[model samples]
Target: MNWVVFAIFAYIFLALQKGFGSLISLPEAFGGMAPSLLLIFGVYICLSARAYLALWAMLALGILTDLITTTNPSATIIGPASLGYLLAGFTIIQMRGLVFKESVFTLAILTFSAGVFAGLTTICFFKMRSFSWLTNDPIEGWDSATQMYRYFMMVLYTTVLSFPIGALLYRLSPLFRFHEKKSY
Candidate 1:
């Protein structure tokens, strides 16, 4: 697996997302969020890697993601963010070969599902066990539907952007190998 490419993409996406967040305000519903295409791309690229190793790497990326997301360094937020990203990465592992076929329907379904999960995760982290706990100040002002919509939109944007961006990156660099691993 190309760990180098994985690291590069992760850094760039994280940097850009962080920069954008600082320059402007993310909508209330989608506040404190960033597009994480690199994790997904990492999964796609390392489909053949050992599950244990992959899980650890994704977890680490998630942690790094949390650290970069906020300056306060909240363990509560960091834990869930890592878990959310890890969940998305591992879940997508099952769909490895099918994802590269260039299909919108597949992408929409995947993004929608992942988005909901990710949304619930962070909400749970910041809030109590349920989303109702989020009704306390910044998040308190947001309605449930609005929060859900924001999450959906955020992930949808990432998925839509990732497809072409990943494809382009795959093409631009000869390093990406399409051949499935036939042996361990």
Candidate 2:
């Protein structure tokens, strides 16, 4: 994988996600779930990249996710998301061979599954941290059930959005140079 190209794409996608996410998200009444562009990109990488490369790429995406997202307005934690993403990426890498990598449906399903896994893992991390004695805030008083509901909703939204986005990424896959090493 070309790290430079991946970095460029990551910056662009993360910017769009941060700048325009709220505009595309569901209303607050429905938990305000938004499709995650970065997650879609990570899904693409997971499907197409080698195991070693995909792990690192997913970690970068996870770290970026941690930087952009916060359960609390004033506090931003990092380790949960990175670990969650790494775990999700590992799972996907292990399972990638069972499906057709080129299918948009595969992308959607994997994205949803991975999203659920990663989201739940992140929630668990936050919940665990909240129980620690040193922390004062507790995820803005949101119960775990509520968080899981909202996260599941967000993953569904992201799955729905992944069709078009995944198709586009498939079209652009050559630029990622994932197949270059296999050509000869």
Candidate 3:
């Protein structure tokens, strides 16, 4: 397993996920939604043709996400996100035998469950950086609940959409080539 090759593409994929997630925002403000491609990509990479290379690649991707996603250099959101990615990766890999049989049922369940796991982690990370969690008033608390609920609704909605997208993207064969790693 060539980790360098894996790292290069992993970095690119993370950047794409971050940029595309932000770029394709809906009029209803779907910023809270991640297309689930990232997680599925991570799963694909990890469980792809090369497991070790993909795992190391995913590690690099996580670090890159921490560096680039938020204006905050020390991204508070990336921490929980990193945690979830790590935990999910470990769990997914530990239970890796299922990849031998790629059925629609299995893929659907995996896609949805992994999508939910990744989405919840993102929601928790983003929601933590806010004023809504600090309110003690009952009325304000109720209002915040509605907002959070709405966000979850959107997240789930996007995750559902991510199923076909992730599956379709996974079917594509990646053409590996050299690309410069631009220095910050």
Which ranges of candidate 2 are over 4 A from the true structure? Answer: 132-137, 182-184
Tens-digit lDDT string for candidate 2 (1-184):
8889999999999999999998999888778877788888998999999899999999999999999997777877888888888998998998899999999999999999999989999988888766767565566687888888888888999999999999999999888999676555
Off by over 4 Å in 3: 27-32, 49-55, 71-78, 99-108, 121-184
lDDT winner between 2 and 3, please give it.
2
Please, what are the lDDT tens digits per residue for candidate 1 over residues 47-115?
A: 535565566666777787677755233332468678876776567566656665444445445555555
Model 3 per-residue lDDT tens digits across residues 44-107: 5545444454455555555555555453443234465565565556655666676652443344
Model 3 TM-score, all chains together: 0.57
Q: 98 in model 2: Cα distance from truth in Å?
A: 0.3
lDDT of each: 0.57, 0.89, 0.52
Rank by lDDT, highest first.
2, 1, 3
Whichever of 1 and 2 has more lDDT, that candidate is 2
